[model samples]
Target: MKKLIPIFILCVLSCQSIDTPEEPETVLEEELMIDILTDIAFIRAAKTSSRKVFDEKGINPESYILRKYGVDSIVFAENNAWYGGQLERYKEMFTVVKSNIEVSKIKFEKLKKEEDSIKKVQDSIKKATGDKKDDKKDKKNKKNKKEELEIDDAKNRAIEEEMEKARVKRFNNLSGKE
Candidate 1:
């Protein structure tokens, strides 16, 4: 009888359910979550690469990222906990995030290479056209160069604004908001 009682008690204790965390009311979609994780990975890398620069800029990387995705810390935490409870799903999400970071790294490196090449070409062209002309011609060339720079700056700003708007729109869509 004592052995049966102890066995019954053990079975009862083992059968009791473990409390699971409640899912957030507004759980971020898996895709959005992956993107957020990827951005966090990038920021983590950047911070490690230059902690001094981040401190000087006074940028809270995590807050900036959460704001970008329109997610609150509390909700993010709840969703993260929910996702983490599913080991396989969380593992898959991490794999996607890592792949995304790797892809971004490759793209950034390619862009940097292209920019360096462009700068080298520009410098060579500038040297070849060194200020060997008359004073009046040189002044005119300088004025033309200044105007071109201004025009380029305006175009660049416009393009940046458009890209930002597009990014926001995509985020909004992913979040199921207007």
Candidate 2:
């Protein structure tokens, strides 16, 4: 009977401990850190073309994280350093980040598919609308295409010029002509 009483008291205490909320600061910091890490992972994944990776466009990760969560690089660095020694907590944060990244990737791909389907429907409707409107569209499209080609040529020339400059710089450095 004495042993049973002790066990029951221990069980009650454990349950009470479980019901208590975590410290608000710890929870907030953990969530912010997880979000920042996930955003970084998404940005890195976005650099790749594979659908298996994140494919969102025009994302400046550091700025986006700061704007969305008010958690900038400095805060992230501080919290990351704080958590570096706590392996279990760090792993937990990373697991959540990875799962969120996967969920985001799937959501983005689905949205992209929907967008492509809508565009296809719009194109079909335009094609079915007859020659009258198309005549004006054709002229506009031709002009736009010409401008695009010119812009592309300029970009290529600029890139080649930069490459030549870099090569010359490298050669000069190698020849001790800094």
Candidate 3:
């Protein structure tokens, strides 16, 4: 009976499967670093632009980090904290992002200047053509001005006549004449 009991115990132990831990899910260092840095960039932008803009744009940073990088908040926070503790690495990553932004800004400014120059050229061309139209318009303007002057002269004459009549009536009234 004791031998049967020992064999039964051995059989039961052998039947139980040992779970070998899954090879620690290997995380790509580069990808993880990029995601952490991107989150930092998003945070900086959010600080300046405000949460209202994000909400209006329907961009939730938390969800964005998850959806884009497949990292949940906990993982992201862990990466952020780890990278943040590494000052040199954090600065290196920050510098890269800042330089990229500066390059884009320079490109945008150059394009803006080019656009402005083109607009100025177009405006000059329009003004040059507009001068010819203005010559014809000047004739109409002169006629309108002359008409306005004539109307003003008539108005003045009527006003002067009314003043004279009023003055004479005041003189008659003062002398006891109707």
Candidate 4:
């Protein structure tokens, strides 16, 4: 009976190993996975900031991302699972994603600043030229400017929130998850 018990345990362990799913046939490239994850992080931040807007627009972020990558949810799930099983590799991939987000934030801010400066210069020139635009045109311009500013503000907030999350994740991941 004692020997049968040991054999049963061995059989159970072997069966569990056998039940392990096979490596997915279509594995997403590491770079592509990183990109998808980065986009996901961005989407998360956007959703956090404007969940109502997304709901109103019927914007299915995860589906859109999967479609964008030409991969179905099943494929993404398989690839994600594979990566999740590899602690070190997944850590490295996330680190890359975090860095990409930082770079994006810096570039976005720089471009935004440049664009604002250019707009200011153009406005000054327009005023200096004594352009007597119609009230309708002026009103339209103001409306457009207001809309643009609002969009920019929303984006800035999302990015800032994502940056904070990234910082926290970076700290936690570095704390040794093993």
- What is each predicted model's overall lDDT from 0 to 1? 0.89, 0.76, 0.74, 0.90
Clashing pairs in 4: none
TM-scores for every predicted model: 0.61, 0.47, 0.45, 0.61
lDDT of 2 by residue, 48-91 (tens): 54544333454555677667876555555656766765778889
Better of 2 and 4 by lDDT: 4
Q: Model 4: how far is 150 from its true place, Å? A: 53
lDDT of 2: 0.76
Residue-level lDDT of model 4, residues 1-178, one tens digit each, is 9999999999999987854345799988999999999999999998999999999999989899889989889999999988987879999999999999999999999999999999999999888664556566888899999999999999999999999999888888999652
Q: Model 1, 87-146: lDDT tens per residue?
A: 899999999998897888899999999999999999888776764455668899889999
Which TM-score value belongs to model 1? 0.61
TM-score between model 4 and native: 0.61
Better of 1 and 4 by lDDT: 4
Pairs that collide in candidate 2 are none
Which one is best on lDDT? 4
RMSD of 2: 25.7
Report the Cα lDDT for residue 108, model 4.
Answer: 94
Candidate 3: where is the Cα deviation over 4 Å?
Answer: 1-74, 136-178
